[model samples]
Target: MATLIVEVDDNKLKMVKDVLKAMGVSVDKKSIKPEKAPNETTALAIKDARNGKVTKVESIDVLFKSI
Candidate 1:
């Protein structure tokens, strides 16, 4: 059997699932999560950046000043 991944809005999720079920398609309740990077350090850094847990460097002078 082939696998299908779909991303739907919260409001349309139920409707999409219902349609698929009516077509005899099995729907898994669990949502698919993004795969992490092979390097744990890189994955953590990416997560931190996404969450705004990063320092903003205005200019080279400011960056050097912090060093």
Candidate 2:
């Protein structure tokens, strides 16, 4: 069993998750919040796509064994 950590555009997070799920992989979505609020902070989300068909991802950060 292996874990993959991916940093993707906030808008594409949902699309990524759906792709992973279709491949029978379990995914977890995490939101990155700034420690302090700023005038305008860009929001980012993290998605953990694990198991099955991970080799199909080509454009996202792929971390093996990263929880």
Candidate 3:
């Protein structure tokens, strides 16, 4: 047997884990935890999201303008 390492987005982690479980693959969740603490920007973004400070884009022009 060979070991494989995958880097997946946090939002997609559950999907990946579910697929692996269906295949009878063993997943070491502890190893998947972040090795270091989140950076300031990441921490701020998470805080903002939890506070419902998100903006909704209704069109492409508005999206590009925000960027």
Candidate 4:
């Protein structure tokens, strides 16, 4: 037995599945898991960025100074 893996964008998932089905491939829904939600730290970072809490540095010197 052989295994093939494909990563498809969310918007194109249905189309890709339909194409695979037409080609006689068995699309295993059970094996496909939904994407995981961001962890607490990542979620907070994203929220902060969305709320304009990001820092912009124009040079290495400035970046190192900020860090």
lDDT tens per residue, model 2, 1-67: 6555466788878887887788788987654557854232122212223335333334554422221
Give the Cα error of residue 53 in candidate 1, in Å: 35
Worst 10 residues of 4 by lDDT: 55-64
Per-residue lDDT tens digits for candidate 3, residues 1-67, read 4343344556767876776777787864423237877666556655665675744345434433554
Stretches off by above 4 angstroms in model 4 are 29-67
Candidate 1 lDDT over residue span 1-67, tens digit each: 5444344656767876787788787976544346733366545545665676755455434533554
**CA lDDT for candidate 3:** 0.56
Model 1 error, position 17 (Å): 0.6
Tens digit per residue, CA lDDT, model 4, 1-67: 3233344556767876786678787874323334877666556655765676754345433433553
Cα RMSD for predicted model 4: 16.9
Runs of candidate 2 exceeding 4 Å displacement: 36-67
Q: Which ten residues in a row have the lowest lDDT in candidate 1?
A: 55-64
Q: What is the lDDT of candidate 1?
A: 0.57
TM-score of model number 2? 0.50
Q: List the residue pairs that clash in candidate 3.
A: none
